[model samples]
Target: MKDLLIGVDIGGTTIKHGIITKEGTLIDKWEIDTDITNHGENVPYDIWNSIKTRLTDLQIGYDRLIGIGVGAPGFIDPISGVVAIAVNIGWHDFNLKEILENLSNLPVYIDNDANIAALGENWKGSGQLVSNMLAVTLGTGVGGGIIANGQILTGTNGTGAEIGHMTVIPENGYHCNCGRTGCLETIASATGFVRVAKQWIEEGKADSLKVRLQEQGNLSTKDIFEIARSGDESTNQLIEYILDHLGLALANLAVTLNPAKIVIGGGVSKAGEQLSKPLQKSFDKYALPRAKEACEIVIADLGNDAGIFGGAFLALQKS
Candidate 1:
């Protein structure tokens, strides 16, 4: 009986894998470093090989597998399973489903990374059972997935709910990975925040945070948050700037969608209250009274595993 499912979450640095049941229970999970070498030409094979090794070790027969689901960064054509562009993963017009299907000989499905995270959160995380919700991921880059009327909103080209690409700065903004300028991702993402911090320090804002950042070469979001909590004026100010933009963008989306819950996920969200409180305040500042009152902001319960669960959810839909 084909009762098992495979969930794969592809990121720039890592690829998370999971074994799931059709009922959405996570059976087991693991991860591997993403090999972005040669435009990630070996990624598909690597994934299949790892799955094969795991299955062999677990003594799970191939017949027990139902299908595979994938969550990848960047633009995707879910219907055709073509990755239009995942710059971080070095894939362009890549036939992800085809390659995986050819390798694993199982059915495959794919969606934007953020969309799956939203689905996962809706299914088993903080946003569970919510009919209307928004899921945002703050990582190396910001990504969003919108749920309206209990359905993931994939625009005509399957690019709906792309909150990160929204233009926050019309001019003189940092360049975005999406070939745009002043995107919310450039301000709200960890990369963006660090970039701005470094720029500020280099531009003559002498501070303890600057010294720490310089000493560490690249600082994690947790490090930055810790410093902010310690009352590092520069770090706190940068956090404020980022939350302001994030809040404003989420506020606009909130009014338009009237979602009941806005779920925060991804690595950066690990800062917990330190990040959420000010973000909520910023959100309240920009959101309509009714919308703000109606919505509840919550941290994602799944942490990094949200994507894996989301992939499972996608596969279960087909199963």
Candidate 2:
């Protein structure tokens, strides 16, 4: 009979959900395959059905639920709960909050997936103790979130923290999905990491990665980092190049927002100190002296759950 919250994180492949207490305790979690067919028309229905089933199984009445919070990809108008577009999910000008609220008769709050992850980290993960922090996710692409004075900055058009699109190499830079070249995403994301490694190898920069790439016919950021860890000079240099761009982008963000902690997450972050050590060195070099002295960079602690936790926090705030 305790008040509970539902957190939903919508991704390209799956939808992750969690039942959490008002106090930020995650009680249960589950996931459902994302049904992006038919322009994602069934997404809201699927989420509602899943939540009802879970609540029934737990003997929790609908009246005990305070609200629902959703973290979705793409541009979102948090004030209106309308998703302008989510290419991955095929949503265009979708009123996600209204759809879910009409279906479940519950108040709903929504925001960008990365922003919610930042909120989750600030509330219960690595940034728990910091009131202001920046959360960066380095996966197939780069995503970022900014928290200032304990609130997510959703800027005009909800694109404020789209840090991936920040141009790092204005000249002769790789093309980004945003239809631009030289974005930080082009050089620092997992895809970018592999692209650079492949390009370097193709240019005849012989290294241990060349053999691995020849054997596997492809390489992941993990594979590159593993080779670098083995002291492959060429691979190490590639990592340094990647971190240099990433560090510069982060440092620029630091000077602008002056966050107390920078929490990094996502698949690429699994490289650990192999990534963080050099990343910090580069950050220190580019960041303002005062900002450099005040901030610390750390890895995300909650992993995939950060989004769900963040969703719950949003629901709690609205309730």
Candidate 3:
């Protein structure tokens, strides 16, 4: 019926693909491992080929497709359709739009992963109907997407609302992948949480976390939260520090954007209310009273599918 859209979200290890209705209903979805063996030079061809095979297997005619939308992690230039850099995916100056368009002979659009996620959440998840909203993802690294006056704000070079790179700690902070020191990502991300916990253990501030780390040979944000629940004062303190910095960063964004909702997603958010309650306490400490009172913090409902929905939204809007 020409009412279907193809949505592709490229991650470091997996590439997620979806067929969604024009109204944002995901009809079918699947994932494929990312082949990064050769600097990702063959990734584009693989993605397009996979989509065609899936369509044939599903008995869907090419006439039913309208366009394709893609979301990836990087400094995406939506205007140029070139991914300037995606460290995790090994794509630099990748002309994503032209390749997809030429291969499929269909309209293709792309945006930053976080930005598409924000659009998806606002359109169908917790931030629905809000013209002003913010979506923050706390995973291996932090990601931010901002919506203002009903439009996604992709400023010049598509770096707008990149809260992860914000300099929350100006001195002696852990190094970020972006080559900066003391970024919020070095404090609020899962990687950041582990780094801080390791530092605390070395400083004799945490005993349970150190023991757990040794037993497991590694640590995660989940482990930290679990330990805190078991009455480990050190782990609790570490959680507080991470959340407090996350809160402070969100607060600064809240005061500036004055968004009606702040939707938190990603791996750390899996902790749920255990993460939100204390985070709200820390946010109230720094946010302006009006901003704090106006914004409602909530968890994302769509989980990982946000990107697929968001990618469909991009196709609907741009093509």
Candidate 4:
């Protein structure tokens, strides 16, 4: 029997799992609600149970599975498989690997969710062609992962590529969830996009978006991009504002890390070229010429599947 790999991506609201072959083919995928209640104490058991049930349904014995890899949102101690903190999921210094292994009786590997996503992209997605790459996720917040010389550069504490928390605006910047001011996430994430648009409306900038905001009570990053695509000058300016900061952040990463490709993912990337075109312009303006020439900004292809694929890759490596 061919050995199978199990990949698990644990999010705030849901847990995604995949059954993959050693050669990187996804055989099956499914999801389950994350029971974050009680400090997420049941999450590990839930995952173990789900995997066991799936294996039973497939009539595959436990020995046929090579290992399990988990991508979780938090500051994880990759070597120890312990999550130091995960505010969204209410995990604190949790020994995730030990618990999951106890239940599945298989070797388990775990890492930060963003890091795993980067690995997934590096292994099979947009960054696959490059030896050095970065994956930046722009969602409610910004998350980043770095691949250096074909390896995940997880820092000593597994928090190395935390690009979102990098301070971009030291003066009069909005507060970040990390209890800091002026993080890149403050101005470049989907929430930041909406915050800027609302600020413009409050400052008496009248445009088509004002009517939409008044009607909808809120605007998504998508809504802003759609307005910009239709030649709305004010919305276009808003997009430029967002891209300016995003570009600056990415350029800094480019000059520092000299990654061959920077793959953009998450909800905000759905803006597509509306985000990339202006973003590339800003990046080129700020990046060192040599670094800028070496790196290309591209969108992620795997979407949500990146994490699962990355998890499976990790399992395959460790097994």
Task: Evaluate all candidate structures by whole-model CA lDDT and list the values in order.
Answer: 0.89, 0.93, 0.90, 0.91
- Kindly report the root-mean-square deviation of model 4 from the true structure over all alpha carbons: 1.1
List, residue by residue over 216-268, the lDDT tens digit for candidate 2: 98888889988888888988988998899999999999999999999999999
Q: Candidates' TM-scores?
A: 0.92, 0.98, 0.97, 0.97
Per-residue lDDT tens digits for candidate 3, residues 1-319, read 7999998888999999999999888889999999887778777888999999999999999899889889888999998789999888888899988988899998999899999899888877889859999999999889999999988899988999899999998888789888989999998998899999999999989999999989999998899999999988878888988889889989999989999999999999999998999898999999999999999999999899988888888888886
Candidates 2 and 3, the one with greater TM-score: 2
Considering only N, C-alpha and C atoms within 3 Å, which residue pairs clash in candidate 2?
A: none
Worst 10 residues of 4 by lDDT: 200-209
For model 2, the local distance difference test gives: 0.93
Ranking by TM-score: 2, 4, 3, 1
In terms of TM-score, how similar is model 1 to the real structure? Answer: 0.92
For candidate 1, the 10 contiguous residues with the lowest summed lDDT are 204-213
The alpha-carbon deviation from the true structure for residue 97 of candidate 1, after best TM-score superposition, in angstroms, is 1.2
Q: What is candidate 1's lDDT per residue for 184-265, written digit by digit as tens?
A: 9998898887787777778876376677877887766677788888988877888888899899999999999999999998
Better of 1 and 3 by TM-score: 3
lDDT of 2 at 145: 92
Residue-level lDDT for 227 in candidate 2:
88
